[model samples]
Target: MDEPKIKNMEEFAAVSGISRPTISKYFNDPDSVRKSTRRKIEAALDRFDYRPNMYAMNQNRRLTKNIGVVVPYLADPFFAEIARIIENHVLSAGYRPVLLGSHGDPDLEIDNLENLRLIKPAGVLLAPLGRVSDAERLAAFCADVPTVLFDANIEDLGAAFVGSDNDQSIGLIVEYLCRTGAPPAFFEIRNPVNPNANKRRAAYIKSIEALGHKPHLLQADGEGWEFEQIGFSEGTRIIQEHDLPTDTILCSNDRLAIGLLSAAYQAGLRVGLGDGCALRVAGHDDHPFSRYTCPTLTTVSQDYAAIAQKSAETLFALIDSSKHFDSREETLFNGRLVMRGSA
Candidate 1:
């Protein structure tokens, strides 16, 4: 005769003649139970195939092993990539990862956090939509749940912040451009979505002025995460209308630079360091597709690996100790300059 299938821990306990609470304790941590009890549980496991629902098991416990990872927009490859790294780290540390995307909406960001609270996650890793995020609500949420902010920060809302140092990154690219060729003009969205854009703008101005160059701003018109389209549309208009004040252009990020490159191609303008090239373009983030553009692209690469590793480690430390840091911590990784064909 075939062995009976045990549907859950309860059924297994009943067949093994073990109390349900003892079985529950064993499932949580086998070492917590007495040796004889553990032997009985192991014997029953050999006879019957029973696997507890991890989610259900966590639901019953006071503190769960779930780690929530929230990003501003998962559709963007940058956020998706970083979220993947953070998830792997959380899983390796023996915790469940619950992923959520805000889609660039503040309300949705808040909703994601609220949902994470329902599960009582061990901790949270959030890449907030800076500037647009509701500061009061986010602060309150962080107060109740231990959260480590990454990517874009919102001041002192979280236990810690981990991201790239915009000042160092933008300055590195700016100095490089000034050294090799003409001082580059900063290209940015008139109304930016990420707060890092503001930092880059300030850094560009400061770096250019320090080098004794007059900074020219080529602010484009757009909002949200459609950076490429904005860059293309605005770039084309600027080129056609003879609006660009400088031959060298430094986009706020690589996605925008990619679109600008397309625009330059459309305008019959050659871009690169080679002879006969009419323009030189560069950007930030060293976007995954930057190297494949027509003339490639010279850009700043964010230290995503370091940011992800530190954020995960910090959150886990908080969870394990059940204690908050005496003071909030912020870790900023410097960006590396990636020189390609574009500039």
Candidate 2:
């Protein structure tokens, strides 16, 4: 049967067979009603899929079960994968989900955020553009709209933050590379986009030192999220210039590794852990496309499920309270190493 479109609360009330005032109470908060009333509303909801206008509900200073999820770059498979996970959670929780991408542009990020504010979303799960983001604008937005930060965080912004533990993830890979072959040189962008890059670099240095091995960095130049291009270009340059100090390389993220892989391939340098392989490469994030590369990438996988759930849950809590948290909560989930053919 075709589901009837619910144009307004009146239509919803008529279909639900509940009084407008009572339905209003339920919409305000499901638990506000008696168990019987709650059951009735829920039953109607299941029989005919009807969701209140998120914007209208918010305009009345009442919450709608609407959430906004924004990412720095959606074209990147990593963000696409994570956004999908978050969307499923929002749908299952009976909230409408909206997804937006910044395309690695700060202006677009601010614009997306402003658009979300106009909707007056009950809450938002944001993966900000890190250092490029307008912190003041974001903090002010969060102050008015319940928000949770994930993927990247800004100090003193939002009600809470959730992300990967870069230290643990990078350390895991660095140790593995050292134990198996050579102390890998870290390959990264000279001007990286994500804030997580800095933490991963720190962790790489710490991990190598702790293992009694000297660390090296192959800092490449890049802007925005063109990680692969940067890595590839840099890798090519290093190969031509004979600048590399180590046979093994660990990248800040998979995108850069992808670029580096291309460079190695063009240079006819074999990449793998086996005897005949001339170079061994590893990366972080285990990007969705990582497994499909010519030589499947060996990388650390972020706990996307955990990050999504934690972000959603924290945003909901802030929405329920209708207040910003005085003390911001920071949560970081660890990454698990996945060995592949590459390294």
Candidate 3:
């Protein structure tokens, strides 16, 4: 037999013989109500199979339990992985997580913030699209909401920022490459969309210069988030033209390094640290696929778990306090050097 469908809380309240406020109180926290009232609500729940319209109820409240988690380029495994962790934390903390992707679009990023605002979320955890983000819009949104930035940061955009220390990660790889092989030449996109790329590039130059080796930059002309394609295309050109200044290459990130590895295989150039291997390659971010590459990739591993946990905790604290932080906070977790066969 088909059961009755209670479409609204008011209808459920009527059917359950409980006042709307009491039902709401139960949903918010059952223990807040008297023991007898709690048993009545439980009995009604089991009998009617009634599900509260949480969104509608929350909308009427000053602050909703929703926590927005926005990430750039969710299709990328790195971002996807971090988003999953953040979602789990939000859930475990008794808050609802609303996950959204900017899809590497600045306008879409702004639209996401606008939508989140309408939800009256208790707080938000955002991984902004650094270089291409509409800073003015982002800053305005942050001012209105308790937001914590992560992954990539825009200056003064949120109550706090959490990300990897690109300088440390890049320098670690540079020093390792120089120690075991020829000083690495930098491989990166011509116009990087992510702010981390710029940091890594500068770190590479600084590290190489400090070690008394001149930095050689091999820039590939490309844009957008298709890093692997750009890496492969530019790597092939470099290999075919024999334009590499050094036998070792340090890619801006693992996605690019993966593409470069593919190019090397296609161009008949062996990539590894052992004898007979013509080129040594390393990358950053320790992308999920890095470990499965033909020779595995030597890269810097971002503290994904730490970044996600800290970002979530920071946002929750801000939400609970219902006030802006005294000062903007910035936390950058260090990356670990993951040595593999490719280096």
Displacement of residue 90 (Cα, Å) in model 3 is 0.8
Candidate numbers sorted by TM-score from highest down: 3, 1, 2
Alpha-carbon runs more than 4 Å astray in model 1: 1-7, 15-50
Per-residue lDDT tens digits for candidate 1, residues 216-268, read 99989987888999999999999999988888999999999999999999999
**Scored by CA lDDT, what does every candidate get?**
0.91, 0.89, 0.92
Better of 1 and 3 by TM-score: 3
Error of 3 at 278 (Å): 0.8
> Can you write out model 3's per-residue Cα lDDT over 1-343, one digit (the tens) per residue?
7658888989889888999999888888777999999999999888888888777788898988899999998899999999999999999898899999999899999999999988899999999888999998898888898999998878888999999998888888898899998999999998899988898899999999999999999999998899999999999999999999999999999999999999999998899977799999999999999999998999999999999999999999998887999999999999999999998
Residues 1-343, candidate 2, lDDT per residue (tens digit)?
7878888889989887899999888976788899999998998888788777757777776556679999998999899999999999888787889899999888898899899877778899999999888888888888888889999867888889999999999999998999999899999888777889988899999999999989898999768777778888988998889888989999999998999999999999999987789999999998999999989999999999999998998887887786778799999999999999999
Residues forming the 10-long window of minimal summed lDDT in candidate 1: 49-58
Which runs of model 2 end up more than 4 angstroms from their true locations?
1-54
Task: Give TM per candidate.
Answer: 0.91, 0.88, 0.96
lDDT of 3 at 135: 96
Clashes of each: 0, 0, 0
Index of the highest-lDDT prediction: 3
Note the residue pairs that clash in candidate 1: none
